[model samples]
Target: MDKIKGIAHKYGNNINTDIITPGKYMELSIEEMAKHAMEGVDPEFYSKVKEGDILVAENNFGSGSSRETAPQALKQAGIAIIIAKSYARIFYRNAINIGLAALELKEAEEILDRDELEVDMQAGTIFNLTQGKTYRFTPLPDRLLTMLEAGGLVAQLEQS
Candidate 1:
């Protein structure tokens, strides 16, 4: 995939799925549910974040429930990708299945809120333009890359 350039919305550890999209909004469509995303943590998250923005967080992002809606809500909310120190394994797969790229970088905490970033998902490279620095993470496997490039497993299967 091409490098994604965007402003980062940085956060701390343990950002669970519930905080991502509360269960109360489960009945709503992804579009409507996205408006409530991160409301529990940041009331202005949906408003302040623009399309193609990158979400940066510390360890255990998506630590709560295993609902697919959480990642769906994020994708609907215009998060191009997520960068975290670590992720709940299920959350990682769900994100990929939902077409949201979630990357792991131990130095994720160093990325500041609103900092400009350019990410090469396939190469696992992150460039913090605002800081004039670059960081790397383990690249995704080829099969996963294919799914992500096709915009999720469903799209990939359809293409086949």
Candidate 2:
């Protein structure tokens, strides 16, 4: 898990939680809701996405309610990581708590859809294989990295 390699699914700004998971589907199980993830913005999203794909986007990538399920849906839908210019504090925390790798790359808009990317979390770098370029992101804190490695906060607590 040192590096994450995947095809990118790029998005635009203001990608809210409601747009990501749709509030109506909130009562459903995480798995069931996952099948409808991002449906509000892209009706074919669930079908279009493949396991281990990376989600890239511009500013404010997770902006609505503090629903942890929003991030859970994406994770369940097989999004391996998220690269965005910025993120809502709540959504970012939720992603980390659930062991979903959500990184911030100021140059996220430079990445294209379906671009093959290799990410080094510890090194804070993204290599865009398709575009033949590299981007750097802010490194994660040591404690947060530890939580992610143990599979989110709950799992980390269990291990402790």
Candidate 3:
């Protein structure tokens, strides 16, 4: 039941895992892989992003390979959360496993780039501060929420 407020960066549909981290950078560490995040689609993404920023996408995000590095790159790049119209199943699971907050909101397309957003996971609401609108999304399941709160699967397992 935590809240995240940040500026949203919008992306289009079908943004796959290869575009997220790129295959070439797969061998690099998380910190290094982060530098190449979204380089395939948005070459300036790394340069423009800052800690606590939110990524908003249209649909089928993380559509390609099931590589976990994609989510890891985003996490390391300081993406606090990702809001999308839809997410690939594997990517969704990988994101939660790594403690990266992701929400599926059909209205996500309405959010514009650089729009300030407030996401309340507890209430399953996304408030667009810039647009003065509120969007409701299905809340993550309790178990998934717990995993994210504990800092992903590994951390949750360690705690038990």
Local distance difference test values of all predictions, in order: 0.94, 0.92, 0.93
Q: Write the per-residue lDDT of candidate 2 for residues 1-160, one digit (tens) a residue.
A: 4898989998999999999988899899999999999998788878888888999999998998999998899989889899999999999999999999899998898998899999999999999999999998888988998999898999999999
**In model 2, what lDDT does residue 3 have?**
91
lDDT of 2: 0.92
Off by over 4 Å in 2: none
lDDT of 1 by residue, 1-160 (tens): 8999999999999999999989899999999999999999899999988999999999999987999999998889899999999999889999999789999899999999999999997788999999999999999998998899999999999999
Question: What is the TM-score of each predicted model, taking all chains together?
Answer: 0.98, 0.97, 0.98
In model 3, where is the ten-residue run with the lowest total lDDT? 40-49
* lDDT score, candidate 2, position 148: 90
Q: After superposition, how far is residue 154 of candidate 1 from its true place, in Å?
A: 0.8
| Descending-lDDT candidate ranking | 1, 3, 2
Query: Candidate 3's residue-wise lDDT over 1-160, tens digit each?
Result: 6689999999999999999988998999999999999998898888888898999999899998999999999988889999999999999999999999999999988999999999999889999999999999999989999999999999999999
For model 1 the TM-score comes to 0.98
Residue 56 local lDDT, model 2: 93
CA error at residue 96 for candidate 2, angstroms: 0.5
